[model samples]
Target chain A: MRNTQVIQVEGLTKKFGDFVAVDHISFEVEKGEIFGFLGANGAGKTTAMRMLTGLSKPSSGKGKVAGFDVLKESERIKERIGYMSQKFSLYEDLTVKENIRFYGGIYGLSKNQIRTKTSQILEELQLSEVGAKPVRSLPLGWKQRLAFAVSMVHEPEIVFLDEPTGGVDPNVRRQFWEAIYQASELGRTIFVTTHYMDEAEYCDRISIMVSGMIKALDSPDNLKKQF
Target chain B: MRRLRFLIQKEFIQIFRNKALLPMMTLLPIIQLIILSNAASNEVKDVRIAVVDHDQSEISRALSNKIMANDRFSLLAAPFNKKEALDLMQLDEVDIVLEVPPDFEKQLYRGEAPQLQTLVNAINGQQATVGSGYLNGIIATLNKEIRRNEPLFFSGLPKHNEPVVVTSNNWYNPELDYPHFMAPGILAELTALLTIVLTAMNTVREREIGTIEQINVTPIKKWEFILGKLVPFLCLGLVLLTVGLIASKLIFDIPIRGNIGLIFAYAVVNLICVLGFGLLISNFAETQQQAIFVAFFFVLIFVLMCGLFTPIDSMPKWAQYATIPNPLAHFISVSRKVLLKGSGLADIKMEFVYTFILALLFNAAAVWSYKKQE
Candidate 1:
């Protein structure tokens, strides 16, 4: 519970009826760090992520994300964070630029701010050529990149990406990782979940969950040596 | 306001661009308006009748001739036996059967009253009663003729007999033209259909496509998100109302005697109630198909209970009270009053208040049902 810790959880648990998706798990993600959350299918990675992102409430325990109380200040926490799902989530019917504008507007950016940031993001992602095209027409890799950029349009303090590169090719995945690195270099924290073990090496710190509990938390190299 | 404007723009583009939705949204309403209008007529015409003549006398033949001359009833075939008449009724070929009993002429001449048996199919009870009235009139005329020629002494006749003295004045719809009654109703129906589908589909579609979570994590307040989804459909509903009104005036020549402004105002209020219901359905449903099914069930019930097919006054006492909160009933009653009966706001003030209060109540329920988290 240092001031520098962006996300602090103590015995965070979620239960749907009698089933416990995420048991009493405790972890902290530091500011400006790429923290990888790894778990098997249905291993409570998503449930824990939902609670931390303020999308779902924990049945027991307490947590804080970005200096806001998870239960009472959920909306305030939402305003400071961005989220992207496993699916390349963007409005398929809207153009890339329109999607960015919509998300930026909802994040309370002024019209001028949206315009400026949209141009910059499009340029940074090398999407200037197809920015006017519908998101559905873009390749899966491009849509994922655009979604990531759209999530960060308001320049939130942190971004949560749940399996952000699920179905893309290896070359595209490499490029997507570069974008993540670029965001981290800009002093933004990245909370990412993935099943690909190799992707865990790219994170500064990694946590592996098994049966609703965090079994290991360390650098990929340290985790390998310990095992 | 700016966030809502952007969301509205996005929704409109999605609706306009979808290939399957464009035709369904635009063409379906027009086609339903034309077809249902024709089927909605209350004027009964071309009734079929089977005659069973047990007596081949001149009086029996004369009775058949009078029924045929009335222009309402069409004789199905030559006189059949009693068995044949019952067979035709069971086969659904004829709606009514006229049985002329044996010795009918002998009983009339012997100073005794003769009864002509009229057996009617009462499946559609209203039509059956009207048909029976027509048949009884023909037999009464035959009795008068028999009395006039013979000059028989009848001492105990009812005193309240006035010949040829029946007149009918149908209120609201003088001609009872189906289109005149149905066009306004269909317009109201279209509002409910379109608003429910659009609003309910708005959030659920986002959930399916994965954008809902992204938006949820943004700074957008819940009310802003909900309003963003609602305002576009409200505008579209108004546009549809205008198109329907123009079609009513130009194509069908449906009169609009009340204030046009008042009608438009009522339409706006009614849209709120429908859109609110749509939002509530969207919140409860986890998928697009579920939202659609839920909305369809409510719309079907609403249309049935709205007094479109049955008179509100004639409904059972409990059912009549239940329809008071159904916005469709209020809108239909107000539209019929304004367009057909030429009623002013003063005449339909109660209906207006009912619609307005229900709209607010439904919207409140919708806002309450929407959760800020999960």
Candidate 2:
């Protein structure tokens, strides 16, 4: 599984009437790879990521995530991956512990499994004290971290994060990246999209998009010298 | 099924957490039932009358006394002539003018039918029409009495030439209690309003806040998500109906004449149809405002034609046919029939079957239109 590619897509594209959001982009992410998708706003990076995560259909191309076809087997793809959107996606009215348990339950975890994972997530994120408080009471930085943790509660083969640290400060972004690294070390492939160049520098490999097409795909260090 | 349970639990927690929602569910329906049933009534009462009695004979006095006998009419003034009575009506002091012509009893004594003129302020059409109908009933009764007692005036006629008497007995709601009639109809309306608006708003709110994007990436099935939404609001609508029923019984003394289970059965189908219609609206609307506007438009039409305040039979033929698809109208009819008329299942089977079909169709549309991925 380590040597195998978890995501394989060829000529994947998405169009909205007269506009092409994602155009014939081809890429493959190996197992345990922290693949960074970076581009300016409206450059189709998010659109491409949506296709991989089974949140949107590819217009006229074939793609597979975790060996499941994105077009036909999206439901199967959904069960094998976790997705965190650009917006904070947890229920703000629910307490931290309830949010975790809810995601765990929805992901097909047994009751005992959800209970154990709830405690484990609370302990790991150091959110045990605030677990009883509503997510609204927590600061912005804490909410984002909890969202990522909840997304990963089922321990999927891949976790797709779309600007998971959009509004947070530098220090919080560092801590959030640490969580991604920890998830990667646990053998979960992290397919993340971010606007921060510094965040792209941390990824094992990065793909830069320009006008709905990937312009460069390589190790960040090699791409830094090439640019 | 496990996923659906968690979704339902999460929805309930959110609904209760919103500060305005609990009162909207509990206190609002009770308040609406009490105020609407009491205020929105068709039975005209306390009509003010001014009598212009130029012929102050025994028969004229008896007619005036008989009009004032019932609690429906009260004497505002006994003016000297029709002009003074007209002046009272002009000042809005009296709603009606009862004119008694000169030689009123003499006309009866001579066996000549004399015309009795009455002027009514037609501004408030319901009050004018129903009030005049009441006056006509009283005058007819007095006319019958005179013919019976004064048989000597009709000596040339046969003994069997007496005027025929007609009596009316109101069925279902005897005494014509408007509140009793209104309570069940309003209950149906509130149930429909709550289920539709709440379901539509909550679904759009999820999309507006982007929780739906998170939900889309999950393994939860489409039917599971829909059931998650439908089940909680369905239960809430039922709870609302129960609260309204209890309140109507306590305040209006509305009798639950039929089997309680039959009412609930119709209510369950009605609510599910309403909720599905709401969800279908939500699918077309991208924002909470859009959902509410669309829901309000349909609800206004539904309530107006649902025969809650006005009888559906009175609506024009096309409008009456249009109300056939209105779930609120059907529910109101079924509710009134079962709750007030003591109607059994066989009596309301048509309404029940139509609503059940709408439930299936609307829910299918809601599911078909709700997309996990674009």
Candidate 3:
């Protein structure tokens, strides 16, 4: 189990010109685990996620994702992992299938792989009927699901979801979690950040961060008992 | 390389998918090239002249007739005095007032160099300069007629009166067809404007929409990313150049003396240079509005100094030196030389070298300033 660690952080810190966004923190996540990074507003969840996803550099600390140093080998880290931003970053003007093909292509996926997976993903998401429509025409829940599906089109080793379930109906959030659990079951690591305590309850393990430092790290039942 | 192709494909799709920007990009150059090119020329034509024929002599009439005979000037009125002529000029009714002094014919008969008073509205300094040149041309032609018509029998001077006629062949643009020169220059301008505005705004839009964050997380290299943004716009730029060339050839009758293939080749280098500069500005701008303002700031300065409207020779030494690295300046010089003058690559080797160097520097700056994060 120790050898199965997919992410390892030791004293990871980040600074933005005198503002400590992510203070010294340490954590680990094993393979095939749903690890929830819980934090309140301005708790540095996003800043931490940015550093882990290679979209930002950590300041004065050590961080690793998928056995690659966060600072030095960000390019390699990018190739091996997936990231779905909270902003719904997929192109709304592009059709659902086009958006899928675009992401898959950028990840160096072949035409055949893209074509075959396009139908598979659309069918699985029950979005086959609307796959040819522009993503802008879809409801927020559908767009959110489609964005997540596009992020994983390249079959990354680990998929980092930054507040993936933000601002969605409870039912949709539940459905989104089901997809996360399914990905975890397939031995793909999931590193998700969320503000919902209930979502944290569904994680295999949870680490609560406050003021750039981790205050708790345990399973849901253990944390509840300790609290 | 494969990832680069994909990124380029994504960019092309996004660009073509943009309903608002696509129409503007396609229409602006067409309208500006067709409408503005004709309006952007320096050749002085159709000057209204108010002639004050005080002498009312054959020589004064011959001079007025010569000014009118040359299709460049029109005599609106033959005023009795210079005051009415001056009034006409002040009212903007005439561009020049030609007052033939009373001794105009008598002075020539007496072998004295009589003064022909000429007043020109020098409001538009270039217009005034050209108008004055035309005035000098009329006077010189009359002087030649006087020299030839003067009888050698008077024995006023020696046989050295053989007229030293300065036959100026306005070569290349013999008729001084302002349109022929303006068409290609405007095309160069259209290319520069379209590529700059498109590349700058497109990159910044991605940042505004937060798509840049998603792209930054990709495994794509920085050079690949910048090239991805540039290649689509470059292809579109080529399309624009071709259309402009065709329009210039068909509508304006602009001669294509140089090799069309050579034109395309240099346009590639020129497009790369302009696009690279645009991308460099985009890399520094944090928002789409900022990108537009900054891009316009540089584009305005570069285009204005590129000799599109003003002659390069007329610019001061410092301004000419400043235009040395301006890619639009290089492109305009190359396009005009190639299209109008039939100049080959050998003739424009220096321009190509400068553009190539500018392309290298601008692309390098664009890549360097592009922060992969934040």
Best by lDDT: 2
Candidate 1, residue A78: Cα displacement in angstroms equals 1.0
lDDT of 3 by residue, A145-208 (tens): 8888888888988999999999999999999999998888878999999999999999999999
By lDDT: ranked, best first: 2, 3, 1
Instruction: Identify the leading candidate in terms of DockQ.
Output: 2
lDDT of 3 by residue, B228-300 (tens): 9889999989988887788778888899999889889999998999999989989988898999999989888
Docking quality category of candidate 1 according to DockQ thresholds: medium
RMSD of 2: 2.4
lDDT per residue for candidate 1 within B1-374, as digits (tens), equals 77787877888888788887756666677777777777776556767898888887988888888878978899885456877888888998888998988898888666556777888999988779888887777777777786676664443454344367566898877777789998888778876788788789877887787678777766676777778777878888887778778877877888898888888888888888888889989989889999999988988888998988878899999999999988888888878888988888898899888888987887778878877576
Model 1 misplaced stretches (Cα beyond 4 Å): B78-80, B103-111, B137-166
Task: Identify the CAPRI category of the predicted complex in candidate 2.
Answer: high
Q: Quick one: RMSD of model 1? A: 2.3
lDDT for B341 (candidate 1): 83
Q: Candidate 1: fnat, from 0 to 1?
A: 0.79
- TM-score winner, 2 or 3: 2
Winner on DockQ between 1 and 3 is 1
**Residue-wise lDDT of candidate 2 within B1-374, one digit each (tens)?**
88998999988888778999878998999999989998999879889999899899999999999988978999889999788899899999999999999999888777677779889999999999999999998898898887778767767656674657677899998878989999899988998998899999999999999989999999889888888999999999999999989989989899899998999988999999999999999999999999999999999999999999889899999999998889999999988999899999999989988899999999999999999988
Chain A TM-score, prediction 3: 0.98
